[model samples]
Target: MEEKKAAALSAEETSAAPSLNNNTAIISSDEETQGWSTQATKRLLWRLDWHIIPFMSLIYLLCFLDRTNIGNARLDNLEQDLGLKGVQYNDCLAVLFPFYIAAEIPSNMMMKRVRPSVWLTFIMVCWSAAMIGQGFVRNYTQLMVTRALLGVFEGGLFPGVNYYITQWYCRHECGFRMALFFSAATLAGAFGGILARGIAEMSGVGGMAAWQWIFVLEGLLSILVSFTAYWFIFDYPGTARFLTEPERSEVQRRLKEDHGHLSNDFDLKYVFQAIKDWKIYIHMLICMAGFCPIYSFSLFLPTIIKNMGYTANNAQLMSVPPYVCACFFTIAASWFADRARQRAVFMLGFQLVGIAGFSMLVATANPSVQYAGTVLAAIGIYPQIPLGLAWNSGNIGGSLKRGTGIAMQVMGGNCGGIIASYVYLSRDGPRFITGHSILIGFVGMAFFLTSFMTIWCRRENARRDALTGSSGPQELTEEQKALERELADDVPWFRFTV
Candidate 1:
């Protein structure tokens, strides 16, 4: 009887138990009306993962497809049909980002007031309609207008979802989930290539060209899947239908205990705090450094492959492999990042991988070698982004702070997309050394900036430890704890994860 009792309390006895502050005992809270155990914790996470992740991932997949289908269409002859001139296609790419970037901060701010299901549903329908509209554009001006609208609708989905994930999972758990969700984008890339190739067969069916069919067909799929989001996306843990009331209480308690400070109340001050903080900007700069290459690759991979002596059809078929490789690497790396509780280290290492890939692209004269470089380059940049955002969310304490920081990070990434659009021009085809070399310099800068962030955070954590005499979360009274929640990560006991 004693042996069974002791085993029940042992968290390390089972691998399925969610992470504990201490592996020696199962954590219990002030109220435990229904029994909580390792198995219960495991089951709760499974429900969250199944219920939230697949739908959110679908949202992300369609979100990315609507944007990068442009890349696919570009290969299928979007330029020729629209009579696009030099830099006009690039203008079409560039026009979306400004509107995309402008909407995110405001949308995230609105997220605090609105439920995620309602907000995301509105955005999805708008963008999918705009995506369908892209199929009918006969002029560059019409193309530019549709692209900009797509941007405004799609911009908030990523950062908003990033924030949404945090409300359910704690810091150690957030990174891997973010990677899983982001992996859908890489999947979209792979899937879209094959889907676009099939949709190309629809050319001349509706008095439309192949490129138009790419937009219209893909947009139609997204619109069909979007309404399901309203039914599927859980508002928060407290109200999840799949979970029992006791399980919901336990889930909420675990999140509160994990964060050390929790509040559902909103105020503008938290948003201002996120904006004024220097850390948000540093992470934003890190994003600019990483996302530039990623955007370049996604927006132009088929074109880059075509320039390497393949037909446009062959290029579309070929683009799938790199994204497949990326999806695998991103999930593996994030799993490691979460287990190790190391963010900056993995992020910096991934940046080195990107730098090396770009070096191969710039130096190689061989097409086979250049194609290998593209895979490595995709491998490098794709995972680096989620790791960076994970780090950003891990450090910020409150909802508004995290929402604002995540939006800012996305903004920096889109800013990189702007730079990316200009870098690989139609004139720079075959061996785009200018684009490759500039990305290398930026990725290198990101490496240094991350190293600085690591060092600075470590120093700050030490200062907090010395001043407060606690390196981890400490027991506190109810009144003092209220102050901690109010101060958020600024509270002395709240050490920054380096």
Candidate 2:
């Protein structure tokens, strides 16, 4: 019954909706895409998916692995060695987020100035070193310092890659690409466990503990990847070295068609303008709410599982399945979201799944049920991150606003990340009902906000459609159209994706 309903919805959407929605590139099903064919566009995307997504995916995978391995380290007796007691471990976790948040918008601004490849590679190198240094930390203070450094450097990659993906892909195309790129994060969760367990046997190796091996080995791998990834990361569509001149032109032209002449040039006005945009703030709020649970789950899943009566080694093994399940679900959801050409519909529905999951955790004292709840929660939480990211980028126009706004949204989310660190208290014990309940609230708030935005965007798009009054984009004067581009999301032809 659900499948049929979904199919009907898909059919209706395909028929009723314009391909060139608010955040989407200017194209139509019946119209020729400038001189470029739709098949050509798909081929180009295929080319880009091959070239761009892999390295970006790998980079994100490493970032997730480095940052969240602390959870795995706990299972390896890191707390005992470092003497992190009571809330001290939580404090160490929380310390990274402020620096992470602080670095984001500035890092994004610099990334645009220097180009993504250069900036992302530099951050990867710095964070890799920080991750390596984490393994060498003798005490909590040193751990805090290394974590802070890691935060500063690792902060850039997520927002950076998000902005970078927008440079290559169209708005409608972004959801899947972002999801595929983010699949690495789920892989990181799964692999972090596998790696953590595998390295556990080496606890006594070379005068280092298993946690140290996890940190050092993963960090060194990142360093190696950072050096090799630079050449593949590439610049914007206009300057891609792998593309032929025509391909580059087609790419840029397609981007220009979709978004009205997005300029990558660093501009103070655009940054300030993005700060002023209410929609950007709404994006920020949504992200802030969404990431609270996301960070909690990612940073503490291993520990959460360990508390479920599994040994640390068994917890590592068990943790892998939820993440593995989430990876597939995340990718599928994004693909379906893109196909439906709607955001809130899928998002709100899945958020309920997450809410239901967490409700189980809070309601149950049974470890098996609680573990099952975690799976549902993982299924619910992971997809929202990429979908929200793509939706945020899709709604915003132009490069400067995109960069600044995306980073700002992510920064807000990381603030939630900080709050997340303290949610699962030691006193909460096996159930951690407080933490689970908190997650339910935050994720529910995110759902409510997204629903509100859906209504707002739909109303705005209707107003714009009515204003255009059957006179298409071609009927508008060149100057008027250029002004629309300058206005970004406020223009008549540009309709926000609900």
Candidate 3:
């Protein structure tokens, strides 16, 4: 009797009992819940693995392709055609980012209130149409409008998708899924390069420039995919009909267990709450500092590659390696991260990869070594983005809070876009020593931010554990128990794994 009683109060049993009743209840409930968890997880892994990743990836890819295709267009005499010179072209790139940032908070708020399928479809179609319009621009004014509109619509994407994934997957599952979606942006870079090479090579078609063809074709594809996202994409679990009731229950239960909390509705109050949390600002800086160099290169990879003496076609082809490396590394890192349920260490490691890549570029004038450095830079830099995103998402509890938190992250991180535009200009090209140096410095800063954030979180976690006296083989929390019904991880008392 003494042994049984003592065993019952063992940390895991004590914490888990809050959700289940006793020994009998434990067996029965585990039998039922585990069955469903296994089934739902399998179904999600199978059905969503290809469909969701590819679909979400397509949206991001188009966003990236449309936004940065201008860099490729520059090689085709876009500036001369528009009678723009000096800083005018760079300014065009610079101006779009502020508007993009301004639009994020509102766009995310609206996306949460409205149905995601409806909102995202509308945004996707709008951006696609805008990209097509970009092809027809005769001067700077027309280009500016198109770019701004692109910014407005694309701004919704990051936050909207971030919110959507939290609804579908458990906390641990989120890192890989987010990485999968992010890698699509990398794929877009690869595809955009190949397409640019082909279109630019054939620029004389119907007297249209290669750059014009690049915009027209990519835009048309996005418009077509927009309709597809509308038909295929599922909203939140409650709104997802393809899954059975049991599957739905399992998804909700797992998600509830994974995080320490969950909430319905897009409450405006959480936005203020999220803002008050200094952690939000630190996360913002983490994103902004890390991404400055990343966005710079995303916009200017073709130009950078051009310096290697690759032909326009060859330069476009060269763009593929970096993006492909980015995609592969991102997938590998995210996979391991989700499996281990870790985030910070992975982010730190990747940032170091970026620092090394950029450092090599800054130090070496040899095109071959520099080219290898670009690939490493892309690998290290691109994967950490989704890691940081998933890490932040895990910490923020309510759906409304998550939405607002992500909106802030996206808006803050993308300020790098503007900084990048200014940092890399036409004259700075070929060997942008200044640009590479700036990237190295920013990546180093990002590493510091991530380290500090991790230490801060660990200390807070220890304090909470000590207060509760529940630290055992399994880390348990009252909030976590409540969260299981409200949020779920693979284990009981799974606090945010940041």
TM-score of each: 0.92, 0.92, 0.88
Question: Which lDDT tens digits does candidate 1 get at residues 138-193?
Answer: 89999999999999999989988988887788778889999999999899989988
Residue pairs that clash (backbone atoms under 3 angstroms), model 2: 22-495, 25-258, 26-258
Better of 2 and 3 by lDDT: 2
Task: Return whichever of 1 and 3 wins on TM-score.
Answer: 1
- Model 2 deviation from native, Cα RMSD in Å: 8.1
What is the clash count of model 2? Answer: 3
Please, what is the whole-model Cα lDDT of each candidate in the order they appear? Answer: 0.81, 0.82, 0.75
lDDT of 3 by residue, 1-498 (tens): 344334322311111001111011122233245555566578766665665667787788888888888888887888888999788888878878888898888887776655667789999999999999999998888888888888988888877787677667766677899988888878888888888777877778888887788889889998999888876776555445566666555655555454333344345666776777678788888888867877888788888888878876788889898999899999999999988878999999999999999888888889999999999999988987889888887776566666788889988899988888877766866788888888888888899999999998777666555654563434335665455434322233334456
Q: Can you give the lDDT of residue 431 in candidate 3?
A: 85
Runs in model 1 deviating more than 4 A are 1-34, 471-473
What is the C-alpha lDDT profile of model 2 across 1-498, one tens digit per residue? Answer: 355334433322211111234533444444345566778878888988999998899999999999999999988989999988789899889999999999999998886666566688899999999999999988889999999999999998899888878777767888999999988989999999998999999989999999899999999999999998768877666556677878876776566556654444456887887898989888888888878887899888888888888898999999998899899999999999998877788788889999999998889778888888999999988888888888888877667777888999999889898999999998987778888988999998999899999999889887877877645435345785576546666666777887
Ranking by lDDT: 2, 1, 3
> For model 1, what is the C-alpha lDDT against the true structure?
0.81
